[model samples]
Target: MKKRLWVIYGMLTLATATWGSAFIAGKFAVQSFEPATVAFLRFFGAAILLFPLMWVMEKDRKKPTLKDHGLFVLLGLTGIALYNICFFLATKHAPVIKSSLFIASNPVLIVLLSGLFLKEKITRNSIIGMAIALTGVVFIITEGHILTLFQYGFEPIDFVLLGAVVSWAIYSVVGKVVLKKFSSVESTTYAVAYGTLFLLPFALAETSWLDVQEASLTTWAAIAHMSIFVTVVSFVMYYNGIKEVGAAKASIFINVMPVSAVIMATIFLGETFTLAHGIGAGFVLTGVYAGTNPNLFKRKLKGNIVKNKTA
Candidate 1:
């Protein structure tokens, strides 16, 4: 049993590395395409690859239903559609690591949101972790700008990344509820399918389809990589790992992604570390640790909120 647990952990860690690099990979692709067009094509590309694969794979599973249609569209819009748009836009302005760290805040946000909705207790550790993580994010965001974010020449493109983080958190929480009715694969497949079609109008209208002849070999390779590895393989591995280990453990693995993003971005995108980055890393890691133990954050918050409610 212990060995199996370790294996699952290994798989999750590897998958996180892959996902972490996804931003860098997209970074490479976005150099040629605008974030919107890039976001649009990524879904279309994934659908072209995975839609057929799903039929071959699912073979006899029951087809999805009407309720599923609604849920799948919502999934597509929130998870794939909006998430990619925000991510591509963000990655363009921010270094891959900073962009990734910003979104990595999701684990902490999930805890707070889940506590509110699911009645999960927030322990002191969780609160401390979240505080530490937020401090890291601010330090990193300011690039250690203690006083003025304005000094950093505030780029709106980065805020798009912030939007992506919130969209994804919502996607994760809501998707979990939808998953109760559909298998993860089913939900994923339909979400991908709907997002592809949903995005098709703008994708075709603006993409300059004739440029297919002019696109360089490198661009083609990136598209293929994004389609197969990032879209298909990563999602499959994540689903597989989640099945093998519980979701909590699976989530912790996601925290590893920022490290990979930072490493890859530094090498690939020429990003660097400042003292602020060091401080930010501490905060982010602290937050991840805080999330691991919820008991500490909850005990304190419970009394305060209860008192506030009664008062």
Candidate 2:
């Protein structure tokens, strides 16, 4: 049991590391392809693999009704299509590390939206953590010059990146609804399929078969890495880890993502890490820890209380 648990942990770590590397891959891919074209190729490849995997894994699952298809389409739009388009666009314009930091703060936005749409309770910690996380995001966006934000307003790319965060939040919230009807693998496969279809027209507008054929090996390799390792393999491992260790424990591994992204961006992209990025990362990770582990302080308090009573 211990050995198997360790294996799960290793898988989770590798999964998150691959997710982090996706930033680097996206940067490389967008250098050669249009944002929409890059997104389309990545998901098109992923959809090809995910469909067969879903079929094999979910043979016992019931067929989706028309209503379920609607929900899947929503997931496809918000999570897959919109998120990736924004993601690639942001990567094209922003430093991969900075863009990744913005995405690292995604859970805060998700929590906020959950409160509004899903009626999930927003705890005191969640609110405080969100404030801290947003502060960190501001610092990252302004590059330590918070006053510049007031003077100049947000850059165009900031809104594009925020679009990615918002779309992902919507996807997660909608996924809660979809999960009630279908397995994760099933829903994800359908969503990817639909999302690829949605991107097809946009991709067609952006590029031709000749452009695709003319793309460098680096671009194809980046797309393959994102599709195979980041999308399919990591997702499977992450959910499996969640199943084995529970969501809270599994979520802790997400902290590894931004750290890995920063390292890869530095090494592969030759991007310099600024002091502002360091501070922002600190706050963002701390805020995510506090927000996600809502019961952490309560548990510690209970332990202290019991110890005091014994004393």
Candidate 3:
């Protein structure tokens, strides 16, 4: 049991590293490509790579039922296509930190949504952890700006990030249902491929493909990394981790992203990493750890079991 637990944590660390470097790659992407174009290219690249893998994973399963097929199509559209669209749009419009904070909201959301759809019980510990994490998120972004609360104006791009968060939350939660019908790899592959199909017109409409020839070698390298490492490997690892570790625990790794982003940005983009950021990140991590720990899950289950006995 301890060995399996360590493997899950290792997956979390690796997922964070992949996603963290993506911030640096994205910083490069926007230099030569529009956010839309970058997103379109990444999805297209992932679709091409993942489809064959999907076939291999699905070769043994019988034909999918009508309901399962429908779910797959929905997964493609919501989880794959729309998530990337909103994320890229958000990134283009807002600071990466702000965009990432909104994306980080997904962990708590998984807890909430799990309660709603999966009948998971929410116990005191879960509530406490959720509160801690949400508060930490506020702290990270506001940087003790509690006093200036009323003066804050909403950024349009942040909404895009919010949309991304909601979309991904739906995707992760819905995967539970789809997993009954398909292997993790199969489901991920199909959803991503079909999702790429959802965004095909946008890529085709990108008049800037003509400009692809004029980009610097560095831009090409960054785009390649985004396509392969961030898009393909990251998504595969996430689904596998969710299967091995459970969605509730897997989502905590999302909080670890900003750390990697900071390091990569400092080294590659010359972005500053301040003490305030570190303090805020500490809060975020604390919240994530509390929220995802199996101890919290066990406590919640115990509470529910006791409530049933009392009833």
Candidate 4:
């Protein structure tokens, strides 16, 4: 049992690490292909793999209803298409490390949205954590000069990254509904197919077949990494982790993503880590921990009280 648990943990860790490396891959991919095209290519490749895998794993699952199809469309539009478009556009404009940090604050947004739309109970910890995480995001956006945010305003890339966060949060919230009808693998496969279909016209409008052919090997390699490692492999592993350990525990592994992205950005892309990055990352990670695991502090407090009573 211990060994099996360790294997699940390892899969989650590796999954998040690959997701971190996606920022680097996305940065390279956007340099050659437009954002829509880049997103399309990534999912296009992923859909090819996911369709077959979903068939093999979930073939016996019940089919989707019309309402479920609507939900799948929503998931595709929000999570896969819009999110990736904003993601690649942000990577094109901002430093990958900064972009990763902004994305790291996503859980805060997810918590807030879940409370609002899903009617989930909003705990005090969630409110506090959201504030802290938003503050950290602002600090990073302004490069530690929070005052300048009022004086100047947000950069275009900031909006782009925020859009990515918002879209993904919506996807996650809606996914809670979709998960009732379909397995994670099945839903994801359907969403990817729809997203790729949605992205097709925009990708075609952005570039021709010749441009795709002319893209450099590095660009192709990046797309392939995102498709194979980040999308297919990491997502499957993450869903598996959720299945094994539950969502709250599985989500803790996401903290590894930004750290890994920062490190990989430094090593591979030659991006420098600033003082602002360090402080913002600390705040973001802390807030994420607090928000996602609202019961953790209570558990610790309860344990301490029991111990004191025994003494």
Best by TM-score: 3
TM per model?
Answer: 0.74, 0.78, 0.83, 0.78
Question: How well is each residue in 221-295 modelled by candidate 1, as lDDT tens digits?
Answer: 777777777777776666566455434334555666665666677787798966776777677666655655445
Q: RMSD of model 3, in Å?
A: 5.0
The lDDT values for all models are: 0.66, 0.76, 0.73, 0.77
For candidate 3, write residues 205-310 as lDDT tens digits: 8636566877777877888888788878777777777676566666667767766676677788787777666776677667666765658668888999999999
Native-to-model Cα distance after best TM-score fit, residue 151 in candidate 2, in Å: 4.8
Models sorted by lDDT, best on top: 4, 2, 3, 1
In model 3, which runs have C-alpha deviations exceeding 4 angstroms? 55-62, 94-98, 134-137, 142-150, 154-161, 296-311
Per-residue error for 40 in candidate 1, Å, reads: 2.6
Model 3 TM-score? 0.83
lDDT of 4 at 42: 92
Please give the distance, in angstroms, between residue 202's alpha carbon in candidate 1 and its true position after superposition. 2.5
Clashes of each: 10, 0, 0, 0
Clashes by residue pair, model 3: none
Per-candidate RMSD, Å: 6.8, 4.2, 5.0, 4.0
The model with the greatest lDDT is 4
